[model samples]
Target: MPDIKDPLFQPYSLGSLQLPNRVVMPPMTRSRASQPGDVPNALMAEYYAQRASAGLIVSEGTWISPLGKGYAWTPGIHTPAQVAGWRQVTEAVHAACGRIYAQLWHVGRLSHTSLLGGQAPVSSSAIQAEGVNVFVAENDGTPGFVQASRPRALDKAEIRAIVDEYRQASRNAVAAGFDGVELHAANGYLANQFIDSNANDRTDEYGGSLENRLRFLDEVARALVEGVGDASRVGIRLAPLTTLNGCADADPETTYLAAAKLLGEIGVGYLHIAEADWDDAPLMPVAFKERLRTAFPGTLIYAGHYTAERAREAVARGWADLIGFGRPFVANPDLPERLRIGAPLNEHDRATLFGGEARGLIDYPALEAAEA
Candidate 1:
């Protein structure tokens, strides 16, 4: 038999951590946490533990502070209870021979006061982010997604506070028995708010030049590094050039490359990038991908609609160090096993994506079930 060991299934080193393979399970939002605030629970622990076969599991975008959450039912790391809850999750994943990292996040202006315990969501500027908030369907039969939330302009002090929140959140992640943390800089969130000139119109030093715009990202990176040890332990997620979801940067490639170079200089552990479109949309422009890959010398993980074959090509061609599977992992808990043998993937049910019980969350039958 020909040797089946490929880069995707081969062990590699990311910073100081050694992983079982180059295949990664990107952070996915499973809104199964407790209400009021999305505190972690036993359900979440079991969910992650079941999928521990991946090389690395970057946990879902966990809110760093109360105002950091845009949607309801997402987990947070600001409170002691939340940290304790995450400890259970990490313990379970560890027992399953999995390595996990908490992806720290802040939604910025993506949220409304109505959702943040009646406190307006804060952002770099007062501009409203143009997008719909995803929420779990209520008892009503209609599909419901909350409208764009009102945002309050943040002052210099508030901006500093935001950075501090991330730092503390990183600390919480470390205390929770996790291996590391990945800053949620993607998907039009806080750091994205600063990077997007449309949302950032401040007259202060934190605005105008690209350097000023990326200051928040750099500061957060520094804080995260301090909270989580070296830069190798702190990764960052970037939705570079995502046109969907109302995210349109003036010059995405230029902006993201500049940011990538900065991250490289800062010595981040790895960069988790959500590729252009991420769906049945456009593939990344060859010119842009080359620039980012060149600037980012460390680990590169690509997400959004990454097929097993494409993942192998990416790693082989040096386009990406690892490929992140989002929906596939959601529908097929043992996605790695399926990909290993070219097995069929279970289609994901959109209705049960957010919050639900074992029905769609954990009930997806494995290959063994199918064989039986």
Candidate 2:
């Protein structure tokens, strides 16, 4: 059993919601949505319900529109059928006494033409994401990773349209019964394309100055706040130092501190930071983390390759209000309990991590079942 002083098992108040623990199951793309319409389904609902013990569960990245899609078999929140499909997921989670948020995603230049009906992917600039690949179905409908196609820059009008799409998606998420919505501004997606320096080279209002670079994120976050009818129901994810999918800023500290201040000004509920988790990745300076805690007044969550000791240390030190465990939550449905009791965990099957049946999605036994 965990000590009474263990911060990881303590209850937390996230806005109006009371979370039972500080373990966050972050949004991870499983690519397991039903095909044809990219709809959520019963299998996903079961998967989430099994892991509802987390303090919060941010659903797998669901595209806001067809154009927002970057990979095959991932879910979307655009159409009526998609919304209905997600209603089942939310109902299931709620019945299990879990709080869940939908992650709205748009994968800008990190997409292939095949996934977009031969239309070019859109980004802040017309640059090909060299040495990066997006998952897509080939001409024969066989899914595999392919080189990202060259993208065209979005016009100001088109940028506004995408912002509107994000707004509507947030509304759809709420209608589908989610507790709130999270904007996937991290992981080299559409919003990150605008924020990162090397990926954006336009000489327009949406580029050049730091304020201009952060404009898209601001608009989108405001739209989400409006869509949810409250600022406390919206969160934004940001990856300042990660260069995933060829998105990297020349000065991440300055860029992200400014971004954090902007989010604070917008009155969003939380700021979730995705730390670079790759081996030998540049460490995010502790000073920057302190600055971020100052910059954003609401809840702060940090997710990466965090061990139980590291997570407790971060939370106990006030660096993170909550710590997200990604792969740990994959194979351990009772992750919070396992961490509390120091129980052994089931190893995740890497082969079935994406676009498969229930083998890896829901087969992991809970602690009781494992013991039995």
Best by TM-score: 2
Off by over 4 Å in 1: 1-5, 136-143, 278-280
Q: Evaluated with lDDT, which candidate comes out highest?
A: 2
Model 1 poorest 10 in a row by lDDT? 134-143
What tens digits encode model 1's per-residue C-alpha lDDT throughout 1-372?
A: 222667688788987788878778888887778755578988889889888989899999899988888766789999988998999999999999999999998988777665576787788887876655655344452335776577888888888898898899999999998889999888788888888666688888888888898999999999999888878998999987775445567877788999999999999989999876444666777577778889988888998777888888888888788889988998787888888889999999988987766777778877898778
Give the Cα lDDT of each candidate. 0.83, 0.92
Q: Write the per-residue lDDT of candidate 2 for residues 1-372, one digit (tens) a residue.
A: 335789898888888988889999999889888878899999999999998989999999999998899998999999999999999999999999999999999999888888899899999999889999888877777778989999999999999999999999999999999999999999899999999889889899889999999999999999999999989889999998888888999999999999999999999999999999989998888789999999889999999999888999999999799999999999999998899877887889988888888999999999888889
Clashing pairs in 1: none
For model 1 the local lDDT of residue 146 reads: 79
